[model samples]
Target: GESVGLHLPTLSVQEGDNSIINCAYSNSASDYFIWYKQESGKGPQFIIDIRSNMDKRQGQRVTVLLNKTVKHLSLQIAATQPGDSAVYFCAETRGAGNMLTFGGGTRLMVKP
Candidate 1:
């Protein structure tokens, strides 16, 4: 995304490697975690999700780690590419509706 209200702008990353983005949540009741990727000027697409009961989840070249102990979360991307470049956001939901609480968001710059 094009940066939050007044927080830090973004971080730059190179292609063909891994990238990790961090996020923190306020609610302790949150039990579900999801990661989303948003290309420029588009809605965020679901990436992967993990339940509070689980600590780790993996997907195609991607991994989501949840730390309920600290109310922290992270997303990891492997062999990143230009197509993989975008703004990534982490979300947490308490229950139904799949409602998501987004983080500060970060832009992934894949060097060609």
Candidate 2:
């Protein structure tokens, strides 16, 4: 079965440096991708998202990129801060929009 998974389970970065998180999905039919940030004891929050039609999308301090040909997705955080530390996940779903397959998640740690 096709599923989404992260290339790395953990990512460490400096408080003021940039961070990149990678994800791969096996389902080629998925048309939408979303990046979520989950803090301890809290639900995942939407950070950014990109449609399969677009190659890249940017929001505030975050960017999302999609490569359909390679079934790859990436999240880039600029000037990462302590508050930005969390578990990030990538989710994908078909056009139905009723179901979302999530990745294993990657833990982001920021060091001051």
Candidate 3:
């Protein structure tokens, strides 16, 4: 079965450096993609998102890039901070009433 997934289980980065997290989705029909950040004891929070029609989207300190041809997606964080440390997951939705398929999360660790 096709699924949306991440390429890495974890990532470690310096507090002041940039970070890139990658994801891959097998369903070409998925029209919406979202990146979420989950803190240790909290619910997942929305970080950024991109539609299939767009290749990239940017937020305050984050950017999401989509490559439909390769079914690849990535999130880029600028100047990663300790507060930015969390488990990040990618989710995809198709034709939906808010139904989403989530990928395995990638734990991001920011070293001070």
Candidate 4:
């Protein structure tokens, strides 16, 4: 099925180290990319986002890069923290008023 998925299901990083999470999408028309962080028994929280027109975008402690050529997306966390441990998902939308298709997600574990 055409969907979004992560190359790595789980990523472990030492506290204070930078972490990079990768995701791939099958849809070539997806225009908006979003990164989400989900904790146990909770809804996904928005981390950052990038548009298809742009290759990269940065937010507080985080950066999102979009590679339209490969249909790839990535999130980079500047400093891993225990509080950052969660399931990270990449989602995409084709246009305004469209539903988002989310990846299976990668679990990020920040080890002390």
Candidate 5:
């Protein structure tokens, strides 16, 4: 219902630098937030996750910050690389196994 009015697109980013991935969520009641990285022709691999109660969470070379005040979320990647190049996705779940809703998506590119 809420996703029916959302945008489904992909964003491209350059490599060997920092990347900020953004996602717009339609529901304001969501709680659990998970970020995933997917390479071509493969399933998503979990990168990091954060709870609605928390403002920020970090992982290996990646950080996920949630702004409940603005109802927005972001994933920051440090020192992106060609090997790190892949599509990033944000998945929101209200509770355990609550049918995760995915955002548009993001593509990261690395240049030598």
Candidate 6:
């Protein structure tokens, strides 16, 4: 038998601190990965993304890192704020027109 996915239920961080959320995926064929943030009662909002060809990518105060060998992915947020508290999800897609497969989300609790 082989593993197919990974999940984290929650994460807590202090205001002004950095946060790192992790995810693991099974599909080796998946070529694109995306991170999304969802506040309570709202749809998921795109945060950042990285292609399998690259190991890491950066945006505003966020960074996405992918490790294909172990099928791991991580999202780092710098200087977390109370407004950053939300559920974060990682999604994968292999080809055009393919629907994204989303990993179990991690709830980020930011303490003020």
Q: What TM-score, to 2 decimals, does candidate 6 have?
A: 0.93
Task: Write down the worst ten-residue block by lDDT for model 5.
Answer: 3-12
Tens-digit lDDT string for candidate 6 (1-112): 2232446698888999999999998888888889999999999999999999999999999999999999999999999999999999999986779678888789999998
RMSD after CA superposition, every candidate? 4.1, 0.8, 0.7, 1.0, 2.4, 1.9
Distance from true position, residue 13, model 6, in Å? 0.8
Candidate achieving the largest lDDT: 3
Provide TM-scores for the models: 0.86, 0.97, 0.97, 0.96, 0.86, 0.93
Residues 1-112 of candidate 2: C-alpha lDDT, one tens digit per residue: 9999999999999999999999999999898999999999999998898988999999999999899999999999999999999999999977665488899999999999
The digit string of per-residue lDDT tens for model 4 on 22-106 reads 9999989888889999999999999998889999999999999888899899999998899999999999987678789999999
What's the true lDDT of residue 26 in model 1? 64
Displacement of the residue 18 alpha carbon in candidate 1, Å: 0.7
Candidate 2 lDDT for residue 8: 96
Which model is ahead, 1 or 2, in terms of lDDT? 2
The sequence of per-residue lDDT tens digits that candidate 5 reaches over residues 1-112 is: 6541113345455666887888777788898888889999999999999999999988888999998886788888888777777888888887566878887677766675
The C-alpha local distance difference test score for the whole of candidate 6 amounts to 0.89
Q: Each candidate: what lDDT? A: 0.79, 0.94, 0.96, 0.93, 0.79, 0.89
- The number of residue pairs in model 1 that clash at the backbone is 0
- List candidate 1 segments past 4 Å from native: 1-9
| Overall local distance difference test of candidate 3 | 0.96
lDDT of 2 at 15: 94
Q: Count of backbone clashes for each model?
A: 0, 0, 0, 0, 0, 0
Score candidate 5 by TM-score against the native: 0.86
Q: Can you give the lDDT of residue 71 in candidate 4?
A: 89
| TM-score, predicted candidate 3 vs. hidden true structure | 0.97
| Candidate 3 lDDT for residue 43 | 98
